[model samples]
Target chain A: MIKARVTVTLKNGVLDPQGKAIEGALGSLGFEDVGQVRQGKVFDLELDSADPGTAKQQITAMCEKLLANTVIEDYAVELL
Target chain B: MIKARVTVTLKNGVLDPQGKAIEGALGSLGFEDVGQVRQGKVFDLELDSADPGTAKQQITAMCEKLLANTVIEDYAVELL
Candidate 1:
């Protein structure tokens, strides 16, 4: 099986309060040196076929269909 | 300089409504096969040194200071 790793991130134009909140939390946690933080997600999909073409198609479909918000987020996929 | 890659994820106990919302959105987007969706973040930091030990200390500080929400998120880092 192919393992597909997907990451979805908020678009630059979108507001990320969660990220902001985390940034605040980190500062309180003794990481006084941290300046900024961006947040997103990672998805690991185990597929049946190892074919790159088919996997890419399936993974892209997964991202477009559910992994990423094309409206507010951007997505990229990596295969392993 | 060293490079650090950081990822922040909501703790399993926390409510990831954003992730849930994304899951529902994906279903509406025609990816009927996706089952569950979880969201997180990634950070790429350019550091002043390439040493692994120092880089790790710096990166960990970055995480504690600004990367992960120790309250609702867990974080891990990698060098790149």
Candidate 2:
């Protein structure tokens, strides 16, 4: 089995209201030094595939098809 | 400015309905050999502090106080 980690993050210049809210909350909680707080998603997947090369390609396809919204988000997959 | 990345994931044995849904979706989409899928959160933060040590401490506090639910989720902070 192969293990993979995928990170999906908003594109630069995209407005992230959730992240903004968190930043505000952090400030209210007395964490003043925090500047930009951008929130993203992470997925840890276990694949039954044997080859790492094929696994990465398959995972990338998964991202493009369902895991990520390619319109506004970017995804990166790391095999572990 | 110091940059840090924080990842928050559900603890083992915790029920993740969303992850389960994604797993099922993958199966339906013909992505066979996919085993377990777990979902998590990632935060990219830019701190105004110049010291990495202090920045990590502050970010950790942010995770403990607001970013993660200690009862169900575990968080890791990395300075980048």
Candidate 2: segments with Cα more than 4 A from true spot: none
**TM-scores vs. true structure, each candidate:** 0.65, 0.99
Clashes of each: 7, 0
- Candidate 2 chain B has its poorest 10 consecutive residues by lDDT at B55-64
Error of 1 at A70 (Å): 7.7
Instruction: Score chain A of model 2 by TM-score against the reference chain A.
Output: 0.98
Candidate fnat values, all: 0.30, 0.97
- Could you give candidate 1's per-residue lDDT for residues A1-80 as a string of tens digits? 66666877788768878767766776676555555455677865555664878878877987776566799989888876
**Reference-based lDDT, each prediction:** 0.71, 0.96
Candidate 1 clashes: the total is 7
Q: Write the per-residue lDDT of candidate 2 for residues A1-80, one digit (tens) a residue.
A: 99999999999999999999999999999988989999999999999999999999999999999999999999999999
> Could you say which candidate leads in DockQ?
2
Q: Score the docking of each candidate (DockQ).
A: 0.31, 0.96
Quote model 1's TM-score.
0.65
Q: Candidate 1 on B1-80: residue-level lDDT in tens? A: 56567877788778877767866776687655555566777875555564789778878876675566798889888877
